[model samples]
Target chain A: MSGVRLLVGTRKGAFVLTSDGKRQDWMVEGPLFGGWEVFHVKASPADPKRIFASLSKGWFGQVIQRSDDGGKNWEPIGNEFAYGAGPGNHLWYDGSERPFEFTRIWQFHPSREDPDVVLAGAEDAAIFRSEDGGRNWDELTSLRASTGSGWQPGAGGLCLHTILSNPADPAQLRIAISAAGVFGSEDSGKNWKPMNRGLSSEYIPDPDAEIGHCVHRIANHPERPEVLFMQKHWDVMRSDDGGANWREISGNLPSDFGFAIGVHAHEPETVYVVPITSDSEHFPPEGRLRVYRSRTGGNEWEPLTSGLPQENCYVNVLRGAMSLDDLDPCGVYFGTTAGQVYASADDGDSWTEIVRDLPAVLSVEVQTLS
Target chain B: MIRVRLPEQLRTLAGVGKEVGVEVAGEITLRGVIDAIEASYPMLRGTIRDPATGRRRPFIRFFVAEQDYSNLGPDDPLPTALSGGREVLMVVGAIAGG
Candidate 1:
């Protein structure tokens, strides 16, 4: 049976929207974690029925949930995230040092080969890996130790929000920390290096420095990991040589400041970005919800906004809120801060609102099953 | 047997009633009781105190016979009423939501 499951993480809980290959009708099944903040939810590539979720409560702290039979039932695994004894500090917004504490698990990357292996990108800028399913987690000390004293927190706090592992070579992994920029590990998270060779950010003190570029999100065609697209704090950039270098691709977009960036499943060169007016005003440009698609990878773009709102659509989309499905027409899905999940089944040509009301969406993920 | 009362949310998570009795061996201190409770209800391991720190979570507290056990050392012996099943030692969320 061919089906699609949209794993959505929201401010209040997690949701699972399932549908057959048609991509028209959906059965929404959640607020699964109920009153907890589901930061990220993902199913392993090796086993679609195995799902992992990062949940947090204000008083109870982080809880890792796992499901064996899809998202139907879940059990708490572990929530103990310790950052070693010293508990180093990162640069604060006020240019002072503050003790680094685990705040949130911004992202999760499950191993392609092992359902038990899971990697979590956490706040205070570090990586934690769980080898025994989601039962326990230990920090990859080298990844955190490699980060020099120059690392600082962005407006969203020091968070390693993006974790991408090379499909062909599992040893090659890349992680992007807010304000701290991108880092790559070639030895299976044992050793890492700063991969911001040509990235430049004027937001920090050192504009042309190696690190401290507020990388909002990074996208690529899973088949071609060498070509990477990034939505930076104020620019849309692309790298052809595996992030060895980057050039501005913010071509004809209305605004370059946005969070979400995604690539079409079938088209390697095709990319999508929903631009906001500015960093402070995190809404669709001019109150119109428009999604810009760059067919040539960069330097050229076309607007896709037939079924989207063109008036009074002031919703903000987070970096991890947009994703793509491997349907024939290539479904594009994203959720907004206003609690709406919209899906475009015709490759961004038209759109449909899957769900209009839920908690404020924090993250969106899709797993294609056969 | 020690009667332990968990918060409403935790009660739901643990799938338990308002009161659950736990059996502890040897001297029934706060640490020993919590160890027994977590051993019985594995899901509540880190809900009260951090697993890494062995210290109480910031917004969680404990109360026994109306006496504050919030700051009591983990190794300290709790009031006999709490350990003897006469009164319930409550694990509560210190902050009010509404």
Candidate 2:
């Protein structure tokens, strides 16, 4: 295994953190994309040298970029995968009817089975697939016109933030939306079905209803593709049979409403989530910052507050801020709204503030580069 | 009339450190307020809106009370309740990925 590198994307720019295994020394290089909002960052699982980023320019539009040499160079793949309205098509923005511009690419994943296949979940609930290592793309029909008008943009652009591909079966994929619950695709995104069995959504008329809930992040164990975990807007859930069915796993967590979820690379039953105030308030619960760890398949959770701020911690971590490394001893890290990055070398047992006084962090990823 | 609250970065460009008050009468649109604000602060002309189309830039987001105003036209009249006293039109810099 090579040294683990952490990539931190923020409101202003992006930071690359290279650690020496020992937590004391770190090399940080960044401010990439120059203030563009980077929603997601990931290194190719098949080739760590390849990197991808999803950037949103607020009112302008969203873009995807690729770097083959570990962030040494970059290229944009926006126009290649963009959905456009043809001559007779009426679904477009403005009078040009230029098919809705991708507002953001909230999640990026490369297929474990096919190194050339890339998956992206974007704002407006769109899922894209690229077969040539992100050089080209095609809109996946699983999230396309078949879902009907009910798939209209949610309050935040009907965003799809998380995409999980089964390590065992490349044909199976799962996606999470902010206000649209969860959907699973069995035929590589050609067709889709709802998988919100035990989820909850207060935004809908029925508070306990499973279908219309808000999902912030979704993660899966690399070894056990049948098990999936997610951090919902108001709850945490697990699906034992991939995403065919789900059960609430937030009984022991501090607050159900959280932004991100991280599953241990090799441990199928271990995962991590950061609890924050739900809809009414967006701060840390009771004015304290804590990361909860679940070892028993989310049946129970324990708060890991060691090396964290004890009081007056008002910063909120967004959905993409937290991430885990695949190193033997996984490195867990998260950035805060107040422009800070914290890292834990021993899973979620203890922590250290790696950097301070940067821009609000939007997402973080760990890449092992020799 | 509708009042617009400038973000910190735009405020600095407008030569003010804090919020700037702009009055939008008639059909209060995002474009109308932006044009008025730019006219008052010439240095901010191309910062908020594009020079040719006058479309809102990618970094700036408009909000009427707590609602997002990005999808609405600049000439669209805001709800009367949102235009009432002390109801501010906020221009915020949206935060993207981590």
Candidate 3:
């Protein structure tokens, strides 16, 4: 089971990567479920053969697709969920009418303890839980209640974009929303509390604000169950007390307003993030793409730009598009909004474009299969 | 007739500075407008619709007024309001996720 499997969620479709343990030759499987935008994709840790994908259908609705035999066959699970009611009665529970309203499942996480328990973070800043492997789902009230009164939508709205569960402790979970900041549940999402004390939001002038901060990605340390890393709108933060409190670890990074974060599968301190322009035009700063690596737990940062394009580059990497493999040396992969995929075998020291001219990739995952 | 507003990217790809206009006789369908647009600008032949299945590409979407045209038949007749120029057809590229 040394071979590495890659699952790519793209704007147009989804792709699977299979490698020959050596990491030299790779097999790419599909543009599966074409004509649908795949926002997030995950391979079940309990059953590597099973894969799940969250897809967006323009204005129709959002759906989840599952693959039991790798990427060979796909099935839509449950009914497609729409964001709002008809037209006028479109106010969410917190009395916010959705502008540019569209139903999209932004993040998906399979329960660390229960294989059937899948958590979904969707548009309108809502969280849904499935107990029967996504065959059915129920909206969790705890998350809906967290949106306080008079909640105004942010740039992406109060979007529930990231959901993370501790591998060592199933009872603990954390979810990051775009404008609502981060919330954690020590009782497996049954109850949640705000965890945005140390996080900073440039959108909000007040540095002491507790909620309404935008978070791009949240990743848990593979070994340390209590340690977690977050790439936020204005800063990168790390929490040692299971998200109870956070501290800024982005001491020497170029900028903090970019998406995408990855933690080493075996090393608790190693992580990666790609930094880009935050406002105005969100392209690579001055049209240059750079992936920053922090090996000393965000204490120090180094730029990894060996094999990436140097000239006329303006691609932006999304949040869930970057990931790491569990292989011995650990392989890193990320996709760009410019429709290209890059891979680095030697940590973040260098890179290579594995696939190009595909649809804009939204998310990427690596599953190991024998 | 279905008046579709081309998104910025599609407008760039089609080499048109502004919206491209096309006409359909009986029914307004993605296939119909796509054919009309490709006929007007052949360079956009395989850009929006897949050459194999003639289905709209993943990033592109069709909207009638404010409603999404997801499950509607491509050849479904344009509503009276849309046909009478009371509404505008939209071919939009949606931005989602992070």
DockQ in order = 0.65, 0.10, 0.04
The candidates, ranked best first by TM-score, are 1, 3, 2
Among all windows of 10 consecutive residues in model 3 chain A, the one with the lowest summed lDDT is: A81-90
Per-residue lDDT of candidate 1, residues A1-370 (tens digit): 6878999999888998988887889989877878888889999998889999988877777788899898788898877788863337677878887877777788999999999999999987889899999788888878767764668887887889999988999888888988888888888988888888777777656656888899999988889998999999999999898888889999999999999999999999999999999989999998999889988998798988988889999999999999999988898999999989988888999988899789999999998889
Task: Report the C-alpha displacement of residue A142, candidate 1, in angstroms.
Answer: 1.1
Better candidate number, 1 or 2, judged by DockQ: 1
Model 3: per-residue Cα lDDT over B44-87, one tens digit each: 55556544345566766777768888556667765556675667
Q: How many residue pairs clash in each candidate?
A: 0, 11, 1
Please name the candidate that would achieve the greatest DockQ relative to the true structure: 1
Q: Is candidate 1 or candidate 3 better by TM-score?
A: 1
Measured by TM-score, how close is model 2 to the native structure? Answer: 0.74
Worst 10 residues of 2 chain A by lDDT: A86-95
Q: Which residue ranges in model 1 land beyond 4 Å of their true spot? A: A84-87, B26-28, B96-98
Tens digits of per-residue lDDT, candidate 3, A1-370, equal 4788888989888888777666666777788767668888897787776778886655324556788887787766753333322222223436566442335678778876667878888776667778888877677766556544324556655568888776777777788877677888888777877888887766668887777677788887667868888988768889888787889888887787788899987777998988777755667766778888888989588888888887688888988899898776778889999888888887878888888888998888887666
Off by over 4 Å in 3: A80-102, A148-150, B1-98
Best by TM-score: 1
1 versus 3: better lDDT goes to:
1
Q: For every candidate, give the share of true A-B contacts it also has.
A: 0.59, 0.21, 0.00
